[model samples]
Target: MADIRIVDVSLRDGNQSLWGAVGLNSAQIFQIAPVMERVGFCALDFSSSTHMGMAVRTDHEDPWERLRVTHQLMPNTPLQFIGTGLRFISWESQHPEFMQLAYDRLVANGIGRFVVLDPMHDEQAIMETARMFRQAGCKEIIGALVYTVSAVHDDAYYADLAGKMAASPNIDRVYIKDPSGLLTPHRARTLIPAIRARLAGKALELHSHCTIGLAPLTYMDAAELGVDVLQVACGPLANGSSLPSAERVIANLRELGHKVDIDDRALRQVCDYFTRLAKVEGRPAGKPQDYDASFLRHQVAGGVMSTTRRQLSELHLEHRFDEVMAEVTRVRAELGYPIMVTPFPQMVCTQALYNVIGDERYSNVADQLIRYALGRFGRPTTPIDPDVLDRILSRPRAAELMHEAEALPLKEMRKKFSPKLSDEEFILRATMPADQVDAMCKKGASKRHYNPEAAGLVKLLKALGERPRQSRVFIQQPGLTLDIRSAAKEAN
Candidate 1:
């Protein structure tokens, strides 16, 4: 039996799932890079446009530098970048020329594999994008069959898409992506074989969340059914909404008589470091949960759920979370249940929140919702509710959006920015607020090393040193001592 390769997603998907993509900074990642490199992962689920944006917006770290440095540190493992359709940092679609440049720069910076996730499962669109990415020098193109439990999404549905992707010259692999963690062992019994039979000789990967508590079992079933690889996260980042723990998954696969060749010592080091860092940073550790059937209805992804919670807490309406989720289910149905992936999950959740809080339902429809009705994205699978569609189109702004042309040509849009800017900075500037990008550039290089145990004491002593007229301060611990002196006092 061939050994099942592992792809570590702790930096990208796991961070996004549990920490809303703000947990790991460059220093934290760099400290673990050398060990992670030695652990023999087939690849690192390193970055996506949303994850990259989080680095810039939250940490004020230059995302490009993080990619380049990580690749330098881990020269052997491929770095995977998930492409959410044809967009960049923004949710809105961009012109082909614009997106091509984005892919070109990603390859240049060190992204080795491209995962194309079209939320709607538009086969033609995925193939077209795969072709473009292949031309952009992407080392591999992996197609995603985003899993959801809709009436129309059955085993055969996925099998057909897998066959289509396998036949495409541009797409090198196919993966079943269960962002909501809804795939069950029973489903896998039929789904995995159906897809594998159609994949010809190409490799198949399985990526599912731990949200509903079914993924761990499903993963075992998948391996038994010929899944080529299993995606996992490390230590504290594992479980809850994130993927399965790498250590546990490897152990189970081996017990099942499947060869999973990984360095146990290095894996233990990864778990220890992240567990310590989680304590130091006071970030929430993902805990395995009992299966909850309610999750199948809303189908909001773990990352999107955390983000929605944070947004609600910021507005002092966190207590109404149940109401928002209830509305999410309703809104999803009205919107024809667009698969719960990337922009669709985000869009559905936003509208649900608005409807929950607004005085009138659908009174304050989000532009994304309006754009969907305007056919800005691919058409919805089932027809949207006539009443909901009518209400959206009746709005005055919808009429104007209906006439909006495809994204301005790349050359014409480039004229809007400075000629001196690189493609990377230009893309960020065009999509995100200019001030955020400026702040990212101004922050310079990020710190490259972190000692979790010292983090708290260092921060506290630094705060104490900043006290007015404090000439010197001394602190002692069981094994460490620190003496701080102000610059003025030293000069004196």
Candidate 2:
């Protein structure tokens, strides 16, 4: 039996897919830290710049303090982060010095591993990011190949690309990142070996989603072919659009004569905790799903799909989902078939939504699309449609974007801002708005303790009781009704 390692993604990608990336608060994460530490994961997919932004914007939580707390609890496991290789957290570009500072601060704050990716498959971009990560003292820099299905993205293409990345001195590991869950078992059988042949014995990990219900099969194939690590989520947060269940993966690996090192009892306890938390929060638990063929057409990432659905529903445009998806296919083709991952899928989906709802085609173009067309993001995998490219380039923003100067140096940026600020504060101020940072600094960390085993009713009651001057409360549900007046008010 061969030994295998696991990287847990329940806090990062799993939450992104199952809860729109805004689901788990710092308090909730703190509650599960001990159990997660006991589960014996080799690494924890803990945070990202986007997560930092969400923490500050939504919950006013201090992201740095969250990292400190996590490190305090899970000292043995390495915390991993994801980045776009350009921006720290914002969509716009930042100075190279600013990005370096962000990386340094991440390493200083306990992030030991970084999974850096460039959606356009730009080799230089990956190398530069890897170099910066090494300079920042990160222990591991994992170069990611964002997987997608396109005419130009065949197995040979990926093999060559993975080979180059594997050969880079700055990269400590390489992982096939299938964010959209488009990789099938047959493709894995062929692609994994081709990439492995060029690795020169470097560690290769497989990170795939369950969006199309083939990740389990794909994982099995990769393990059989001798991949080093398998990225998975715990049970309640696994399956659905997330990765397959870790416990299930371990059981399957054992059945297949592989030596798994995880603690099954601790794994079950973590799973049971999340199961209750999902119930209390009214969140959907991850479950196995049948394959959906339409996923190939849109190629929208599992995480983005849930968030997009919610946004459209809020605007009463849920009925136009199919139309928007169809438009995504057309727009993606016109824009050169960029992988449907972070920022790109968002840009494509926004443009498609505008096209579908507008009075005429190309009536509304998002700035990000114009930036993409102007070559700010990077070159496309394939040539964009000529006419569409011309139309996009003809926009006023395109000309402005074309003439924009290079990003400023770190020293000049510090002159503009305050050099007295700590590296963490400076990175936050550089990437995010000043007002948001100030608000987060003022509010401080949340004091709530999120008990995973608390019942939904108990949580609800506790929340209601915390409000001041609440005279009475009423609730009505199917065959249940209750009203309670405040004791002080009743006595008065």
RMSD values, in order shown = 3.0, 4.0
Every candidate's lDDT: 0.90, 0.86
**Per-candidate TM vs. native?**
0.91, 0.89
Lowest-lDDT window of 10 residues in candidate 1?
Answer: 457-466
What's the lDDT for residue 212 in model 1?
85
Assess candidate 1 and give its TM-score to the true structure.
0.91
Show where candidate 2 strays beyond 4 Å.
Answer: 302-324, 353-364, 446-449, 453-492
Candidate 1 local lDDT, 1-492, one digit each (tens): 557999999999999889889999999999999999999999999999998888899999989999999999998899999997688888778999999999899899999999988888777789888988999999888999988888778888899989999999999999999988999999899999999999989999999999989999999989989999999999999999899999999999999889998999999999999999999889989899799898888887666888899989999999999999999988888888799876788899999888888898899887778998877777777889999999999999998888877788799989999999999889888889888999999999999899998787778776875678788888788987778777886887
Query: Which residue runs does candidate 1 get wrong by more than 4 Å?
Result: 301-327, 349-364, 469-474, 483-492
State model 1's lDDT. 0.90
State model 2's lDDT.
0.86
Candidate 1 positional error at 471, Å? 6.7
Per-residue CA lDDT of model 2 for 299-322, tens digit only, reads 986556777788789999999988
